[model samples]
Target chain A: MDLAAVVVYEILYTIAFLALISAGLAVVFGMMRVVNLAHGEFVLLGGYAAIVSHNTLGINIFVSMLVVAPLAVAVFGVVAERLIIRFLYGRLINTMLATWGLSLAMIGAFTLIFGPTTTSIKAPIGGFAVGDYSLSGYTIFIIASAVGVVLLIFGVLKYTRAGLIARGAMQSADMASAFGYDTSKVYMVTFAAGSALSGLAGGVLAPLVGIGPTAGLLYIAKAFITVISGGASVVSGLIASSGFFGIVSQAVTFATNSVIGEIGLLVAAVILLRLLPTGISGRFFRDRL
Target chain B: MTLNRRQFVQGASAAGALATVPSVAMGADSIKFGSILDTSGIFEAYGKPMEKAHILALEEINAAGGLLGRKVEMIPYDTQSNMALYTQYARRMTRRDKVDVVHGGILSASREAIRPSLRKAKTLYFYNTTYEGGVCDRNVFCVGTTPAQQSAILVPEAIKRWGKKIYVLAADYNYGQITTNWIKFYAKQAGGEVIQADYFPLNVSDFGSTIAKIQKAKPDMICAVLVGAAHLSFYRQWAAAGMKKKIPIATTTMSSGNEHKILTPSEGDGIIVCQSFSPQADFPSNKAFLAAWKKRFGHTNDIHEIAASSYDGVRLWAEGVKKAGTLDRMKVIEALESGIGYTGPTGKVTIDGKTHHVTHDMHLIEVKNQTLTIAKSYSQIPPSDTQRVCNLEKNPNDTKQYEIKI
Candidate 1:
């Protein structure tokens, strides 16, 4: 393939990956009102688990992810809720400190256990060619799987009885409980689902990006920016912001240097966020809030 | 009763006299050696093994009856790969721990960061890592090859082989910027011109756009100075982009012991890495070093260029101390400045007393089937001070001249 086509294909694939991460973060925040600083660690855990399984058991990448993704997120959800996150339900300051500490501790623990080295997973499906343009089969799979997940989530929330109860609980916990809803169970399940989404995203992304202990630091900042810009509402705001930010950043990097591109995007985002206190999509959710 | 008192006084005097006898028996004492390194962080892959090598060298020397008949006690501290922590640990080693000599540092930034503390404490700092060198300090003895030693040999050979319309891709940091400058200078000297230059952040994963620009530039060869796993990512993406056949890639700083393990054999093939040491270099010293290393570490993991250099640094310091017949810091410094050659794992290394830089053989290696094969070895390159415009020999203690060439 020619160079231009290759660049376009890579940028699209990266955007789709970012959108999945942002959507996962948006769901948890929207329901629980908890800022999960340890979210990136969970992603790293899933990636490492997949890498270990691939190297040791000789399992295919997709098969490994099927086992790793749900287990990582479930473990993280239970530990986070029981040990620390429970105390920070209403206190933002407490949540910030506890989660930030959790993030650092996780980084240290992983480095000690795994050593500071980069690990990779082989692409499950190889590349395919269409005319003069070549595309990675794994990249296409990532895009399709993410879309399917989003659609599945949208359906569950819109049509299922459990989905209605979840929406009601997020809007008003006391009112939902007064209406005979099991708010605690709903909260637990929502947190687990959000964590699971992050794990799934990491598993799919292991081949595209190599996993390192400190790799989570880079993604966490961008994910937080996407979540804040999207107004921490339903997954729609997240999907929109992820696409917008990813494309802008990639295009700017193509036009100039990556450092300059990052600076420009971050500066613009910060200014827009300051001007709009609630966020870019805040106006749409004003009546609901 | 009076007789008993007199006997007691005489006995106490005799005991005091015996206590001072050992001091006279042993006139001098052994010197202490301290090392500060990142034991757990991003750079630990380089630093941890380096610490192990230092300890091994110390054990070998002390087993041979110590330096100047004084046992060498090594005290090592983990810097955790943080710059602030490096300074704190370095100071604590010199002032509180009172080590007579110091060694160890992996990153050029970390080395530069700890310089002030090394100076203020007046402890002799033996920097063991290869760096972008122009530094000359009374307290600092650089044992690794500078950019001049590395690039002066590599660039000319590259230009001789490929008509040098060169392209530069580097990490956006001090080491990358300065090393790229050295390449540009040497490339120009060899009647070649650089067509394009680009810098990327340290953690960049995607090289699709950067590779596109490189392809558009259409240079005869590209010189890259990226380090760590980032190099692996860049190589995979570049190869997948199909730029490998069109452009030949070479790097002075990218190849290290740790990097080879991370990248698959196929991904790293055909890339040329110029370095001070290669595991495949045909030297008896290197063969022994590798054997001992594998036996102890339980794998054939290639020791990093800096780790061997650091190991050599400890041995050289021991030799200097032995030759000087004293543990006095100034005497050891004077001995090191006497232009002596030491047989080391890399090869025979000669220290330039005037420049305070070590000159040695450099190897050009190509990655083939997951193994580093030697392409060629350049035995001699001018010391860094001679290549630069300034005369560093006139003032060995001058700090300003260190930045000019580096």
Candidate 2:
């Protein structure tokens, strides 16, 4: 209702959004040891897809996610694996190069298709009014959906057969293959799922943020910051790092200007990363690493 | 990574050999004009259209009995929207291609990068886009509105029309920061105060926090300096936040009619844009220009404000060449410095001989429904001799304002 509440609301919403994106990237890097630079493009594709579906087909923004989110990530994952990523197994530099190339190509292709313009997807539920402080329905949905996804992923990886195989492959790919685990299929499925998570983040955030061709650059940096800050255990670490960064960014912006806020957060991120190479949460997941 | 003597010698020899070639020789053929554009990257929306306009202008110029009794030849290179590539391309154009004059650079950074090269090459450069000015080079002619031309005029009018409380939102780049500074300075001069100022990177998409801040500030009007497709996003988000009706939006860059092509009608409606060119200008030259552009591009309703300026740049350059009766860079520069006025599509174009900056009519346009209609036009604003004043001083940042004798 007041200024402080509004600032708090902004800080929380931003944290939730950032955490959702960073979670998928953290998983891919922490669990699979693949940087997946094209991860941001998957999000971009989802955002664009949401825009198209909403504008062209006149579908409900929330429902369009069902078609766009999974499809974008799956398409990227399949194509990436088939053309470039499959060869990058166990080679970090090669993986980085391949994914970086894929990122540039996708950015170029999307810009050509979408005309470098920023387009918006409508909020599914508009806004929920509470006294003088109104929260966007889309933001609420994003927060809820991201929480749901984090839980779902936690459940799948903790209690499921496929996730166990993924964990095994992540630990030692050669050993997992020697033990009759289909490491190739595991890699494909993990990449696809990671990409799908990114897409879901994009789809949900599309209404809240405008979709543009080069919009992924900042997010990619932010996601990396989250991943590195979170350390090796992808989900929880990334969530915590995202929250931390989001709060810092909001606080700085509130204190001064947005530009200074961004610069300050980035500088802080660099210093923190340097001091804690394994990251803030890396100590908790030492056994996993 | 160290180079051996033999390798260094070979590289030096190649460079020397390349330098010996005469770039601007008259071969009883077409006169070559160099163009550097961002065919790829974030600025492509502005760059591609500009390239198209340049080509179209060259075509029309050639068709109408070429400049200097020779058909005009355009040698265009894509910078890919990188500053390094822009410098490289500018060098290649002047040294390798031997273009008589150079035109292009949608972003101010690109133009700034190529300035030293332009001075060294002694090539006449026609900068054809709106910019934050304070630059005055003998070799360069700025064909776009300087901060004085756009913001100086817009801020006062905006403050008068929509109270004195203002919010300034700009892109976090050279153009944006400089323009915002100019706006702030002039807003204070006009007895208005900037309640808040914020900036976003060129590619920023989310405006929720920024809009929230603007709402809290409750400024009478918001002055935006965003460029390209990003404006569409800002407009939609601002409207969605319910601040569009509460605060009147005034922008130096975003209110251009070209934005309407990308944004929905509702998103663009009621925003006042201060610019040199508007698609709704009812001049005879503009009518002919629009018709020709539509015919060539086969796009009926998507002429950006920059297109007319670019077209005017080429036309003005050609006129200078004709008047000078030579392709000599110095001669062309002298002719352009004559402060000659030309009737073009956007309106009467006048270059300040002293500033090398073009001063023209500034249009205040409002988007009504879907079409950009001219709400008002401020014409004959005397071009400030800031360049002349600054040229005499060592530091351009000196707190001195040139008095207009008019």
Model 2 C-alpha lDDT per residue in residues A1-289, reported as the tens digit of each score: 5767778877877788778888778677767788888878888888887778778988777767756766777777777886788788889998998899989999889878887666666555644544444445556677688778778788888889888888888888899999998888888888888877888788877765667777787578888887888887766676667778888988887777777777777887888788888887776655442
Instruction: Give the number of the best model, judged by DockQ.
Output: 1
The two-chain DockQ for each candidate, comma-separated, is 0.40, 0.32
Q: What is the C-alpha RMSD of each candidate to the true structure, in Å?
A: 6.3, 4.5
Angstrom error at residue B48, model 1: 1.3
Query: What's model 2's lDDT at B229?
Result: 57
Q: Which lDDT value does model 2 have at B308?
A: 76
- Chain B TM-score per candidate, please: 0.88, 0.86
- The deviation in Å at residue A4 for candidate 2 is 1.9
Error of 2 at B24 (Å): 7.9
Which parts of model 1 are misplaced by more than 4 Å? A1-7, A124-138, A284-289, B1-28, B120-122, B159-163, B229-232, B240-246, B300-302, B385-392
